[model samples]
Target chain A: MDENPGLSEQYRTASPWPFFIALSIPLAEAGILFNLFAVAVGGLLLFFGCCAGMLQEAGYVDRPWRSLVVGAVIVLAFGGLLLYADTQVANEAVQLAERGYAVLVAGIILFVGGLLGEVFVDDGEFAV
Target chain B: MQLNGQLALTILMGLFLVGVFAWLTRVENWSGYTPLSSGGSAVSGESGYVSEEKPAGIVRWLTTVDHKDIGLMYGAYGVFAFVVGGLMVILMRTELATPETVLVQPGFYNSLLTSHGITMLFLFGTPIIAAFSNYFIPLIIGADDMAFPRINAIAFWLLPPAALLIWAGFFPIPNLIPAQTAWTMYTPLSAGVGQGNQMNAGVDLMMLGLHLSGVSATMGAINFIATIFTERGEEVTWANLDIFSWTILTQSGLILFAFPLLGSALLMLIADRNLGTTFFAVGEGGGAMLWQHLFWFFGHPEVYILVLPPMGLVSYILPRFAGRRLFGFKFVVYSTLAIGVLSFGVWAHHMFSTGMDPRLRASFMAVSMAIAIPSAVKTFNWITTMWNGNIRLTAPMLYCIGFVSNFIIGGVTGVFLASIPVDLVLHDTYYVVGHFHYIVMGAITFAGMAGIYYWFPLVTGRMYQRSLAKWHFWLWMVGTNITFLAMILLGYGGMPRRYATYLPQFASLHQIATLGAYMLLLGGIIWVWNMVQSYFEGPVVEDGDPWDLEASGLRTVEWDWFDRKLQTKIADGGEEEPVTDGGVVEDESADELDTDE
Candidate 1:
């Protein structure tokens, strides 16, 4: 039987990434608006995770774990830069350190998760 | 660092979603939806290899990326938003009836007014147009589906969260209250500086929701541009591309430019509110007028974004009922493009009363008035198309006629406002309100209805009750003119808008408008009931050309696709297909009967 009933091979049937990607933005926004660190870290993690998943699903990346590792490095660098700015700058209202903390924590969790996936999960083993 | 109940709830919810995402990713069967039945494009035998299994119930809707299914979802979502917006205005109109804040407090009234405008424009207007375009664009252009079907689904899925965020203030949440800022979200006031509840987190949520909507619209626009450019069948060339596709293409261009600016403006405003930025702060070097400059730049084009598609709807649907090809179809297409280009230049005319430079205002005024030329061209073509032809006054035709009638009034009123002198007088008054409502409600919504009724059979595979549809049309016609015209009269009497209270002198006209609102409410009820009852219980359409478009050589591609679907279903013994013999091609070969180019 044909996998996709009516559509061509070029079109995706459905993907779980969009739903997660869409859900992640608002959660992140709500976290920032309300100053909730746990929610903020969780949202950023979900957002980056879904992006990597989407990239791998589209075959843009052979190993999404490598992409995630690269993503974690960038995020960690961004967080480190913000923390460095907080030390040099003196704007009371901006709260650079707090934002940096959230980003750093999310980056650390993503790094650990990606490292594990790199060791254990094989490519194309989880293709939906 | 305080762990509160709300924070805990957010964490738990986030974890649950992550778990669901993980589970869904692990499950294997990600091949498209199984067609549950033999009807509806499943047996059309496109690209070979038919599947006999279809997913049933909620799962089919939640995960399917089919353009047709997604279009139906968009339609349902838009209608639901319409009901929400309508109820908000009904409360507002009832309060305006007595002019003494009889029904609700002033703050809540402000909330309702703001929500109504935003909800109607962003929620109902754009999504409803998407509903039509998504379903029909592929069929008409002879594409398999949208260019990026997953992205199309993603675009739609974004809107639900956007709506929830926009309406979050109305939900029962601590420290959250509906933002009283009007749909414009002008600065200084929208900067959360006032003693009013503008400082609430709800305002931030509203802006974010609005930003999400812009993202969704931009994505959809990109898809339309790609699909129309890359996915059109060989026969459906640019020269003969339907007027509706032309308008969608042009509107997508406008969206591609306009919505990103809106998203940026919204983000800057959000940063200003939360992070102490002075981008829109009055005292800290960023002038409040700068916000208006950025907003109306996108905002003015946003008006055309809401309007041009409906104009396409009327242009495309009108001639079919008039029993003629559209008069000046190329001119209509050109006018659509012309409107898209000129829409950007007229943004500053909205700021004439703000004491901008007179020289600058004059340029804006000239461009504003010049933009009216293309609009007038469209109106003229519609009337000329219907002039001497056999005009069938079906429900859709009545709405199209009403669209032209109301558009003339709206356009003329808007022309006067485009002049610096008149706009200065009517800057924030009831006149501005009446003028836009004429275009938005009287013209745009009327065109939307015409499209809906015209394509009812194609969407639902059933016929709507004709008598009830006519009733819906008349009530809305009489109701719209009454409500909006009284507003014009009140504006003439120097009544201001965005007020919960007014002098007793304006009471009678306000009451008249309220009476008109009641009529519209009744009409809306009839429409919903008729559509619902007709979909499940009404007569199922057997003949493919339900409107008998072939009789005038006016049959288009969608109906041909529908004819094929009906033939396939009949061949599979679902229902016997009836012969459609009454058309201009009656004597011709059956194969050529569906050709209408």
Candidate 2:
């Protein structure tokens, strides 16, 4: 078995423009406005992982179509879960749902940010 | 997918039978072996690693610092303490089973309940986790030994004598019976003179023992933190730290802050008990509330210290079996830190019904509820980690899943208890008991089992009978849910905790719980049998990565460096391998390697 080269090298030269335009904008809107935080966050995470995978496959940063598609699906899921929660529960359960939504949004933002950061920033410079 | 009691029971019994059969078959077989020289590749390898030479005398067992040996010692001591504590609980349950003081005198029963609660929490729960951490953390982190190996030995040595002193009141010593005050040993009640005029010497001794245990724990915590931070091999970077190592770091941080408070509080109590001081005395000079504040401040975070390491272990093992990287590794790590910080603020929630001011109670309630957010994050991360992954139903993974289920119940109930209005009604009731034990025993114990099963091969160099491990999990799951869930119902019926006797209406539930407790005991016995028998006879694992899979793109240093240590130890005649691929590669045997590059 040959030594498995790590993903860091592939991500080093990728462009951040597609990530910022396609995923970050919609995630930020969903997170701040509709409060479908969990979906937003989960989507963002998926997007980051996807982007990393893409970067590894194609040694470049231009994959707007894939990022946009993944980001939209994430937003929809958050919105759907929010609607379901509002219809299904009351009182503390409702509050729990709301909090879940907020966290989801935060998670998405972090994911997108992490991926974008990985692309734009020098890997060796980032301490951990 | 819908599980019912009958099916669950049958599955459990089947697992038990399989486990027994596996154990029987492995009673005389062995395979994997590593040369002694290779053992030093992990960690710094400065200390002597486990040699093929087995020690022949009793002194060898006592003085040994071998990770495996220490692990067994911890396991044995934890089991002993658990049995002692369990028996006390059984007596309390039997008495409560009738809603009357049928089992023993009221005072003696109080002693039993108090001793049982404290002993199990401090002696059993904490030490059992320590047993695993002590045994496996070094190995998994790719270290040859703990940073402070002698201190490791000292830590284990301190436990038995401390435990003996705490429980010494139970034995017929001259004028000493076990302390009647509850495990928390609340001031005034704890300070009160005994009925037999025997002086409060037992309480004093208990405090002293607790102090000793705290010191020992502090030393161990320092060792864990230092070892993980400083001793990781060059290839093992911050991101590449193993889940268990992460857990040990967090747990050690909790201990660093929490145990010291406990030590200081114990010191104050000791002074009050003997020096005629009024540190916790009531009325004009002494402040009873002061003790409550000090104790709970440490007490609450202590819960996390107990639960977090196991949580870390589960996070590590569950993903492996689920065939996925932990969902949101950074998030889980953040949540752990959040829990630790928030744990400090929520201690006052425990004192809500103790006549704290309304404003204070409300603030505590808010803080307590806030802490739930992090806990919720952790739960969500766990589910997501397992979602759509190629989940393996190994014994360790089962236990990890069980931990999630149990912790969910525990965390939800905690939210209810965090409310001031709800707590006023439930304070000192069986509801509180149910809530905590669910978290402590349910979450922590389940996590411990997950870790034990996950790391059994690494620690013992032998594979535990899978059938038996599965059996142990199922029986324990049923027994734990039944026992603790029944307590929740009992609490709803307005049954108060710490009462030797209860109203007749609570009898049926108490009886059921006691029966469940016995099942728990039986499950535990099966586990001990499996572990012990496997130690001598289980199949030896030769593969470097026994789980047969590794997560790609994982960042922790443990995976990068430690895994290679095992490989090199087996493949290259114990010679130090070159540090390759941008990670720590300390090559003590550089002269031996014939490098063509």
Candidate 3:
């Protein structure tokens, strides 16, 4: 723990993606737009997680207002667009259902990308 | 336990393992107990490095974050799994002793076969490699430890529960489902719910275990990838990072791609059984072949994943014994990278009999044959490295020789299997069995043993009994040839594999193979006993470089670490502390020893 203490903490703190992704799986099995619901939740969580990490890396003593606002709005808009399809046009449900898988996969990639934010080496180079 | 009970059992199992791990490393002291330190030769009255605080009894091991300690644990555990897996094979050989089900029921035999393959490949192969890699990579790459040490710990900690879960049905519970899916766990058969009252809760558990192993391997791979790429002490680079790390780098990349896919497949299989979706349910949108396609995609590269490290170890070890730098060093590295890319393209070769497209089959056949070229290059380079050289016939060197010899047969037979014409006839025969085992048992295990012997002194700081190691190596060689060669012959005689009973024509071959199995088992036991007993009480290596590294031109980083420790112990003028051997005498500084010399 003594060797670069902060690195150990970040490594130890569990990632949110696994927990959310696991939750989304059973929900997806419930059928229909429930799968899309899972995808939306996972993406929103990951977006926020990445924001938190990026904010920390950028040396923010307070909340990263500009970035956090930009991140939250972008995430909420994307998720809201999908959720709105659940109640609106009948074709919207069909379209979102088909694209749910694509969203889920994108979420996974985003989470992997988020990992890069906090895991850079001491020389400020990316670890991977 | 039933599938329904697993959700809770999983939680409890996790807690138990974590608790045990914590309990193991939390002891008070490790002073008298030198936790498996391998160093250079010790000179009389010279200072030796002694750890002051000793963590008490077993806890030091359980809680250890030290790479060397972890490596020793991995090596010991791998050997234990190897012995257990081997015993299962011996029982199966006995069952086939007389071309009849003489020893066990068909189902039990199936269970044994399945358990043996899983244990050998996942439990034995990777962990043993992990043993060597963990111990050496940090020292070799000039890093203090793995990039993510805690993740390394987590990766290893996943194994015990994984092992328990795989063989869960056979112990503590009676008549619960036994996972008989073999190593492949191909669909339709592995669906688990199709057979009434024949549901293998073990399949789900096995898949869960497989998933855990994938996570473990992936974590290790990520750590290796990071360590090699970033932690190289300014002097090391892609060109000069050493052959073993380069191979590990390539192997880690493969694992990253291969293992995650395996994990996804295993998870889908779990969903197919528990969830309503039929990802592999035949007659539904999903079918059996999907499983095979996905599996072999990961499976073929997996053969490389298991063997690549040993291949690297061979490249690293062979040169020192022969008193030369490895021949075609750059070519070997290029060939290794070539094979890593080419392995992904050869997966379809395993499916030649699956009625795949004729064009596809032919292409796969070509690529399968193509993958052999790099291996051939490796072989020629090894032999040339050994040719006209001052070869020291040490135990490690002898195993390297055996590795090359067995891998030739292994590789050639693979080419034979790669031909669509021959593969059609020999798809599930004992020839395939013999060929893969030659690579696995003969090449990889042989090289693994070579690495173990060559580095044993470096790790334990004590020399094994040379006479016993000689007996063990010869016995292993003789046993391996006698057993696997008999298998090839049986295949040529049209004997199929995974059969509990065979025609009377196979009686002699089975008996011969059985005898060979007995020999292998005896030899393996001797090796294990030699390691255990010798580690604690064997003669300490007085001069660290037993292989005479100064003359050999073998400049490995571990030798550097050995030099540093020796120098530090001398400069400190540390008094001799009771090491693992329980023998101590008054010690003088390295300066005094140098003056005497």
Interface C-alpha RMSD, model 3 = 17.3
Contacts from the true interface found in each model, as a fraction, amount to: 0.19, 0.00, 0.00
Against the native complex, each candidate's DockQ, computed on alpha carbons, is 0.27, 0.01, 0.04
RMSD of 1: 6.6
lDDT of 2 by residue, B339-427 (tens): 87888888999899788899988989999999999889989999999999888899988999999999999999999999988888888
Error of 2 at B169 (Å): 0.9
What does the lDDT read for residue B301 in candidate 2? 88
Q: Residue B471 of candidate 1: its Cα lDDT?
A: 92
Q: In terms of DockQ, which candidate is strongest?
A: 1
lDDT of 2 at B256: 97
Ranking by TM-score: 1, 3, 2
Model 3 scores a C-alpha lDDT of 0.71
RMSD of each predicted structure: 6.6, 24.0, 10.3
Off by over 4 Å in 3: A1-128, B1-57, B196-198, B570-597
Docking quality band of candidate 1, CAPRI definitions = acceptable
B130-167: candidate 3 lDDT, tens digit per residue: 89888889778776667655456556766776677677
Give the CA lDDT, 0 to 100, for residue A117 in model 3.
Answer: 36
**Better by TM-score, candidate 3 or 1:** 1
Model 3 DockQ class: incorrect
The A-chain TM-scores of all the candidates are: 0.78, 0.32, 0.34
Model 1 per-residue lDDT tens digits across residues B39-133: 12222221211122223345456656678878988999999999999999999999998868779999999999989988999989999999999
